[model samples]
Target: MDESSRRRFLALAGGGGLVAALGCRASGARSELVKPLPDALFIRHGAHNAETRLESLSPGQLVTPNDRFYVRNHGPTPRLSAAGWRLEIHGDAVARPVSLTYDELVTLPSRTITRYLECAGNGRAFFAELLGFAADGDPWRDGAYGVATWTGVPLARLLGLAGLRDGAAWVMPVGLDGDGYARPLPLAKAMMEDTILAYRMNGGPLPMDHGFPARVVVPGWIGAASVKWVGALEVSTREPMVPANTEDYVLLGADYPRPPPVLTTQVIRSAVCMPWPGLLPAGRRTIYGLAWSPFGAIARVEVSLDGGHNFTRVARLIGDDLPVAGTWWQLELEAPPGELSITPRAVDEHGHTQPPLSQQRLNDKGYLFAAPVPHPIRFV
Candidate 1:
């Protein structure tokens, strides 16, 4: 990264920690994770979830530090060593069932790609806090996502090795944590070259807070589809309506389409690096933030000083703008004293931009809230 780029990205790293968990508070299921939760880097949501503090993103640091990445667990993080790890591939859709030990799995051809992993409910808090649309689950405010370089065997290679038979419609990766937590992926997505069973994160062996031993890393899809501590891949001829899919990630709300659309690829989203509710002294400064999409690279970013009524394109973009990955940007502006709200909206390569606040609606689970909402600030 260049000097100018590094400084732009570092501006977001200056804020203090979030004072509270945005909206509703819940003591969800207990997590068995043994990793330490340092207050400076994370905002805790009960015992199971630890949200990454966006302000911790340092200058020129594109790959999220494994230790600072967010943790969303349904159960406890299991203790598994590579020597004892085994991956079972089976189901009616596989012509031949196969079980590969960790050693055997790593011997296969592997690929590395940098992409962002984000929860389907990453911005759930906006629903209730901004739009008055009540949502369930932990109230996350854009911290449930991060970018990482993942190295692993392409999932297609594994399926091929197991003789993936014709007529397979879904691939469900089951985890070793809590009742084998699993979510189904369409066979087509599972066969995509970018989909992999990753064993390394940011060039290091996976951390326990992440998936130790191995985990699924499905690019361009919701994070839940990338099951951690994976133990088995269950190929099926039909959709596997597990709670992760049908009950949880599925869109729920009176305004949504009937049958509730099951979330697949994530949409365009962006967030400023400063504090959620920031206070600043009157002056001129450069604003920094990151924007991305599952469909493509960000085409442009516009910031609005007066809520969502008006917007101006960011002064410059920093770093490589890879598809399905995020890029940092900076905008120079003059500030006046008193109350202010800065809202950043991103446009993707597909011509998709954030919905206006007028069009925002609540999903039953608060799965996707991509509309632009103001980031309140006080300029003293």
Candidate 2:
């Protein structure tokens, strides 16, 4: 919280009526708050200090520009009154106790998914390989991740409008930028499938730093349990009460202090959002990247040019996958003409392969680097 207290909290949440959450539709959003000019955005400052947000235009575009989308503020950026928002459900298998506002939770019955909002420290600066390029959190050279189209209200219809009596198991979600954070999920990930409570993004009404009147869209876990300015939701069986939502995504052992409990199922990752530093330009070329996996989809994205040694396979998934267990991939590759430095790497079909950035500095914990993107082409 520097830079003039984050520009006076985005000028007090941009004149107190913020709403323009990207992708997934609604309408009308305009309130220019602190866009400290870097071509406008990629994910600007907050959490290890922002400003890695780039690509304001052509980079093979595909939705990521609701004010250059990518502002993940875990604290400081709360300014409500979407006609006074509210959302609550009681404690333990709620058979009673329900509340909703913000246009009655967006007039219920809504679901629009096009997920991919990464930032488990998206490429944590390749875990600072001691600054040979890539260093811990928000040196964020890789565009802090994007891809939206989220719309809301679904978490199984607001947990079936608070009617689940029979030993609830976990679902704690309390946020309004709470200084101590809270996130808990289980009860089968809040009754699984398309978990959303989002208001509307990329179509309108929601952009108070990407979580306007409300937020939560846990599609494919690990985004700090998808909590952002959300009001409250604790219909517990006693569990997700937060401790960094069960110890900072537990899966430790990169030589640390207390780690391990990160159950497998999300490793193969990739990124190269239209040649930012992946630099390219030489004879009929085409290369795009964005891949994911909490375990599923993204079964191929291997581009190597004398770095990770050898490999080539790109199919971008214009078909097959998404049988509903969440695992994303969106690729496009084309290269041929001498002098290169390419490295994209990705593979998931339960095979999970995408690691390098000095191999996460030898076991500190899955920073999950999908290195091989250092393209420097120029053959004119």
Candidate 3:
């Protein structure tokens, strides 16, 4: 970040600027939003955030359409032309600092990845609503995540071009959004071939709301790790201490360490594809949902139509079963109809399954709530 960027960031940091810059819980969110968030597909959180409506999910839909993808913006979406965009590589750890134009980046080498990007606070609201734990941040239901195919140049290739120094440990990709939004990534993770500076999404030029010219897509990690509208990759020997890692995304709770652990890979989470507090006719019906884990592929999905009393395994896993890519599962049940509670639990290949409500603990920000939440529906 340059002096002008530093000054702008400082200004945003002072006087309750953190909430605004981060798009945390706030009023008048629509006033600050820049994208056309249609009500049919999304539930707007604030100016810089819009979650996909899980009810809109259809059977066999493997990829989240570009327009329907959830948005998690640190600041308003930036409108940068590919012709004018340049990705700068610099810092003490970089031996040969260089700036590459949009055209130059795409021409090198490229690969496409089908991965799921989820916010650290994707199910934040569940803590209070389901677990009775008070927490802060957006009240994201289970819809703050989506899977998409991202096409881009590998970060490692770019780092190789820049020539890294011996002690290079952290790679912080800075965004072009206000105050240069960014987060520090470990050198090891940055070197992974899956980590890419994506320029295209779902087979089309990245939308302006989604970082237009380019963005970093860090699969399996918290969405914050994948900064959008990326403008610079600042390499460093020491860990970079920005608001994102230090204060915002860090886990805060009495159960956690004094400093709070910096959130990383997403947890095993599952969600039903029906409306929250939905309705269904009294008869035989099939229940459908999606489940995923950063740890490994989902091994099994169990559904409890009668709440937590008993769980029945889904008929089969559907679509792609890629670990970080997520998979869909469905089951049939005879409905006697009245008021019904449907709970879904997923077990990953590592044997990690969603915890029951009895085992859930409170976290300050309501992050990573992976307990089995019962979806309520009325049969008419």
lDDT per residue as tens, model 3, 1-380: 55576565334322233334335323434344555779888998877799998778776686888778899887666556676677788889999988888889989889899999999898888888876777998999988899999999999999999999999999999877666778999999999999999999999988877877889999999999999878789899999888888898988888899677998888888888887788999988887888988877889888887776788655478877886878888878787869988888899888988888787767898877888888888887
* Model 3 regions lying over 4 Å from their true place: 1-35
- Candidate 2, residues 83-114, lDDT tens digits: the string is 75577766757898787777888877788876
TM values, all candidates:
0.89, 0.34, 0.91
Per-model clash counts, in order, read: 2, 30, 0
| All candidates in order of lDDT, best leading | 3, 1, 2
- Residue 127, candidate 3: C-alpha displacement in angstroms: 0.7
Tens digits of per-residue lDDT for model 1 on 71-142?
988766665667666788888899998989889998899999999999888998998988787788899998
The alpha-carbon lDDT assigned to residue 289 of candidate 2 equals 52
Candidate 2 matches the true fold with a TM-score of 0.34
Q: Rank the candidates by TM-score, best first.
A: 3, 1, 2
**What does candidate 1 score on TM?**
0.89
Measured with C-alpha atoms, the lDDT of residue 120 in candidate 3 is: 88
How far out, in Å, is residue 345 in model 1? Answer: 0.6
Q: Which ten residues in a row have the lowest lDDT in candidate 2?
A: 19-28
Per-model lDDT: 0.80, 0.58, 0.82
Flag the better candidate by lDDT, 1 or 2: 1
